[model samples]
Target: MENESPDLQLQGLHYLTGAPVRIAIRQGRIAGVEPLNDPPASLRQLPWIGPGFVDLQINGYAGMDFNTLPIAPHTTSRLSRALWSEGVTSFFPTVITNSEDAILEAVSAIARECEEDEAAGSAVAGIHLEGPFISPEDGARGAHSRAYVRAPDWPLFQRWQEAARGRIKIVTVSPEWPEAEAFIRRCADSGVLVSIGHTAAAPDQIARAVAAGAAMSTHFGNGAHPVLPRHPNYLWEQLAADELWTCLIADGFHLPDSVLKVAMKVKGDKALLVSDAVMFSGMPAGTYESHIGGKVVLTPQGRLQMADQPQLLAGSVKMLPAGVSHLVKRGLCSLGEAWEMASVRPAKRVGLPFSAGLEAGAPADVLLIEWGDAGGDGSEPRIAGVYKNGVSVWP
Candidate 1:
C-alpha cells in the first residue's frame, strides 16, 4: 500500500492569531483549518502560516527581466518558479513603458509562456502594463523613456490586449492628458483595472479620473515631481480620495516611514504593498547597467539608485517579504498587518480566490514562514515552505 496520500495537513502557528493550527489541504484547496489538539512545547518554535504573497507589480526578479527585449523562451516560467522561494505564489508581470513593438513583443511572450507552461499559467495572474500612456514630464515620467511616452490611445492599447490574448488586466496611466477620463472609462468598462500613476495632473484631473473608474494608485508617492504646491497637489488629492486603493513600496527606502504611516492610516484596508522590483532585485550589491537608467547602484543597504544621482531611486530591489519585514521593524504596523499588506490585501484588491486566506474552499497558496527572533530588530521572515495550489513548491 502507498504510504502517502494526496491530502495533506500543515501544522504551524496561525499568522493572525499566533495559535497552533492544523490546516487541511485536499485537491488544491484548503479543506479546513482547526486548532491543533497537541500544541508544540513552544508556540514560537512553529513557523507562521499565512497566504502566499500576491505582488501586483513585479518588473523582474532573480536576474529575470520581463521588460527587456527578446524575452528568453524560458524567462517567464523560470521567473514564476523562482518567486516561490520569495513566498510569492502569484504575481503580475509588469511591462513598463517602451516602444510600441517592444511592448507588444514583451506581453506576447508572457502570454505565450502562460499558455504553454503550467507553472507560468498558475503563477501569473495577469500582466500589468505600466506605461506608454503615462506622463512625458521629466520627473513625472521617472525612469521611463520619454521618447515613447504619449497620450492615452485606446486603439494602441486594444492591439496590445489582443496580442496578449486579453491577459492585460491592469494598466497604469496619468490623467494629465485631455483624453484620460474617456480612456479610463473604456478600460473600466472592459473590466480592466486602470491605475493612476506617473502623473503631473492637476487635482481636479485626479478627481475626474476617480469618477471615470481609476480604482488604484501605482507606487503612489514615488513617481512624481519632487516639488508640488502645498495643498492642491496630486498627492493630497490621492490621499483624500476614499475610492482609490493605494499601493506602497514599503521597502524602507522608497518612502519614508512617516509617509507610509499616513498612507496606511488614510487608506486603511485599501492600502496594499507592491515590490515594483527590477531585474536586479536578487542580484548582489554593485553598479550595474540597466535599461531603465543607464547605470544604477545597488547599495549594501538594499537601496537601488541612479549611479550619478543618488537622490533619485532607480527601482526597488526588495521583494514582498522584505517589504513586510520593513513595515514591522519600523513599528508602522504589526507583523500580521504588514503581511496582509503584502499578501491578503493585494490579493483582495485583485479579487483573487485566496484573498480570504486559509479558509475552507480557498486555494491553498500558503507560506510557512520562519521569524528568527521576535523583536523590532528581528531578522527578515524566511520562507521555510511555499505551497501553491496545495502542492509544496519551495522548501
Candidate 2:
C-alpha cells in the first residue's frame, strides 16, 4: 500500500441528520464537511451520505458459516462485497461456539484474509468470538450445539487468541459459572471487550460479572430462558445497570417494537444494534440443510428458524441496514437515531470514535443511500455508493 490518499467530493444529504453537505473524501478519511453550495457542473450527486454500518455480531453471511473449518477460499471477499452492497463498510466476522479445531481454523482463516487483502483487512475491524463459554440450556442456548459448551478456560482462550493472531476483539460469556468473574477480569485486563450473553445467570452473578469488568450485554433481550421472574431477573438487572451497554437485535422478530422502544429509551446513548446473523443469512426464504443446526428455514417473515421446530428462531438472517429500516418503520426513532444505533453506536462500543465517519479526520467508511418514495423505511434502500477509506468499493 503506497502513501496514496485520493480525493473525492461527495455532494449529498447527511443520512443521519438529513442536512445537505459537501464532504471532501480524501485518502480514505473525511477531510472536510461543509454545507452544500452551488458546485461546478461535474460534481457527483447522491441523496444520502452517512457512516458505513459497523456490525459486531455477524456469525456468517451468504451461505458460508464462519465456524466451519477450512472456510471457502473466496468466502471472506464474497461476504465483504455482499455486506458493502448493503452499506456495511466495516464489520466483525463472528466466530461462534464450535469444536476446538473448527473454531481455530475459522479464526485462522479470518486472520489470513486480513493478512492477504488490505481492503478486507480494513473492513474486518476485528474478530468477534460468540463463544463456547455461553449457556448450555436449550432455549437460552439458541442454536449453539450443547456438545461444545464448556467453562471459560483462560489458557484455552489464549491458545485460540494466538491462532487468531490476537484479532479476537470481543468475547461473549455466561456469568453464572463460578469461573466467569475471573474470566471476565482477565479478558478486560487484556483489552478484549467482554459481553454478557446466552446465560441463565442470576442477578448477583450478573452483578459480579460487571464488577469484574463486563462492559456490554450481547443481544441483550434474546438468548435467554423464555420465562423469568418479573422484577429481579437478568433482563431487569441488565436494564438497570448504568455501567453496561446494551446491544439489541432489532430485526423485528428478535424483539417487538415495544421492547425495542423500551430498550432504546433505557439505554439511551448506550444502546447499540447487532445482526446476530448466521451463515445462512442472505439465502432466499426456504428450508435448507444445515450442518450445524440440522434443518433450518428462511421464512417469508424474514426470520431464520429451525425447520422442524418453527417455534424457536435460528440465528438472524438480517443485515444491519435492513434492521435500521425496520426501526424507522416502527417509529421507534428518527432516521438519524436509527442510523446511529445501527452504525455509530456499535462502532463506538468497540472503542471506535463517534466521528468515525462524515467528520474531518475520520476514516472514510461511508455510504451513499438513495431512498425511494417511502424514504427508506418501507423498501430496501438504494446503495448508490460505498467508500472504504475514501475509495469507492461499489460500482
Estimate the Cα RMSD of every predicted model relative to the unseen true structure. 2.0, 2.6
| Predicted structure with the largest lDDT when compared to the true one | 1
Candidate 1 wrongly placed segments (more than 4 Å): 1-5, 372-377
Cα-based lDDT for every prediction: 0.91, 0.83
Stretches of candidate 2 off by over 4 Å are: 1-5, 39-46, 353-355, 372-377
lDDT by residue for model 2 (1-395), tens: 34345878887777766667889977767889998777434333446778888888877887876777779886776787788877888888998888888888998999888888776787888899998999999867866889999999999999999999999999999998898999999999999999999988899999999999998999988988888888788898888888899998888888988888998899898988888888878778898888777888898878888888898787788888778778777778877887888788888888876346577998877787776432533566677887777777875
Candidate no. 2 TM-score? 0.94
User: Model 1, 315-334: lDDT tens per residue?
Assistant: 99999888888888888988
Candidate 1, residue 95: how far the Cα is off, in Å: 0.6
Steric overlap count per candidate: 0, 3
